[model samples]
Target: MAVKPNQTTILLILRIFQSLFAVLVLALSSFVAHWYNTTTVVSSPSQINFLIFIAIFSILSVTSLVILPRVFSNRAVANPYILLGIEIKNVLFWFAGWVALAVFLSRLLFCRGSVCHAAQADVAFAAMAWICWAGSAGIAAVGVFKGVKKSSGNNVEVPSGGVKPEAVEKEAV
Candidate 1:
C-alpha cells in the first residue's frame, strides 16, 4: 500500500531538497574560489565577492530550512500565528537567496572566456540553487496564507477562582 503524504512529510521533503541544493552551491562556489585564486595571480575582484555571497546564502538557507520545518511541524506546540510568522521569515530568507544567486549568476556571465570555464560548474549548481530557493520561498508564502492546524486531541479547561458562573449569575439576581 502506498502511504499518503501529509503536510509534515511534504515539508520535510522540500527542506531536504533545499538543503541539498544549498550544499551543491556551497561546494561549487568553494571550488571556483580555490581554483581561480591559486591558478591565476590576478583575479577579478567581483569573483571573490560573488563567492562570499554564495557561501553566506548557502549556509543561511540550509540552516533555516533544516530548523524552521521542525518548528512549523511540531503540532504539540503549533500555533497558527507563530507558524505564519516563521513562514514569513523563511520566505524572506529564500528571497534573499534569490537576490544573492542572481548577483552571482550575473557576475559569472559578464566575466571573460577564460574565467567562464571555472564558473561553468558554478553556473549549473547556482541554477539549481536558484530554482530550489524560488520553490521553497513560494511554498512558505503559501503556508503563511493557508494557516496551520492545531492538534485535535488536547483541550483545556479553566477552573473558577472561587465561584462558578452559575453562582455569580445567582448573586446578581
Candidate 2:
C-alpha cells in the first residue's frame, strides 16, 4: 500500500538530501583540488571517489526538481514568489551556477594541469563529470520552467470542460 508523506517529513527529506549533496560537492572539490595539486605523486584517486561522485550528483538534483515548485506556489514556507517576483529567477540562476561549478571543479580534478580532457584518465571520471553537468543544467532548466509557470499565475486549473459564469461567480465566494 502507498503511504502519504506528511509535510514536515517531506521538508526534512529535501533538506537532508541538499545537505548531503552540499557536503559531497564540497568534499569532492577539496579532494580534487588536492589530487591535482599532487598529481605527480598519486596516480589516481581511489574508486571511492567515483562512487561518492555518482551518489552525490544524482541525489543533489532531486531538491531542484521537487522543492522549487512548492515554494513558488506557497505550499512550502518562504514563498519566493510572494515576497519578490525576481526571487525565482535568482534561484534558477544559482542552480545553473552550482552545476557549472561542479563541472568545472570535476574537470580540473581529473585533467590536473590542463583545460583540455585527457585520453589517459579514468573514463568513469569523465562520464560522471558530464552527467553531473548535464543533470545540473536540466535541474536549473526545470527551475526556470517552474518560475515561468508560477509567475504567469497558471496554476489555477479550469474544470474538465469549462465553467459557466454563474457557477464561477458562485464559487468565487
Candidate 3:
C-alpha cells in the first residue's frame, strides 16, 4: 500500500504532543520531588532517585520518538531497511514511554502520608502530563501496528502457474 502524506503528518503531530508531555513530566516531577525533599525534615532518598530516573528515561524516549523520525524520514533515498529500523524504534520508544508514565502514576498514588508532598501546581502538571502521554503512546502504538500489518499485507503469495485451481476445475466441469 502506498503511504499517504496525511498519515505522516498525523504521526508527526502525535509525536510532537508526546514529546511535550514528556518534557512536562520530567520538569514537574523534578521540581516537586526537589521541593518536597527540601521542605520535609524526613528525607526520602529513594523517591528523589526515582524521579530523577523517570526524568532521564522520559528525555531519552522523547528524543528517540521526536528527533529520530525526522532524521529517518528525510533521507534522500527511500531505503526499506532504514524505514524498517525506524518502525522498530518507534515501537520501542512508544512502549517504553507508556510504561514509564504508568510507573510515575503508580508512585504518585502509592506514596505514604505526604511522603512525596507535591505542590498544587506540580500535581496538576503531572496529571496533565499523564493524560497527554497516554494519548501520545496510544497513537504511536496504532501507527506501529498499522505499519507492521501493511508491510506484511504487501507480501501476498501467488500460485506457481499464476492461475487458480478453481478456474481449472470450472473449465473441466
Candidate 1 lDDT:
0.54
Candidate 1 lDDT over residue span 1-173, tens digit each:
99988655665676676667656655666665676678879663454446446646556655655554445444434443454454455445445544564566576536655445546655555556556555655665565555444433343221211123344476799
Each prediction's Cα lDDT score? 0.54, 0.42, 0.50
Candidate with better TM-score, 1 vs 3? 1
Candidate 1 local lDDT, residue 10:
67
Instruction: Write model 3 residue lDDT over 43-153, tens digit each, in one string.
Output: 544434454455466556556655554455434332334434544554454445445544564666555444344433334444554555555555544544444331222
TM-score of 1: 0.55
For this target, which candidate reaches the highest TM-score against the unseen true structure? 1
TM-score of 2: 0.32
lDDT of 2 by residue, 93-164 (tens): 334434544464466545434312222222333344344344434443444344432212235532222223
Best by lDDT: 1
TM-score of each: 0.55, 0.32, 0.46
For model 1, the stretches where C-alpha displacement exceeds 4 angstroms are 45-48, 68-115, 148-150, 154-173
Quality of model 3 by C-alpha lDDT: 0.50
Model 2 ranges with Cα > 4 A deviation: 38-94, 97-173
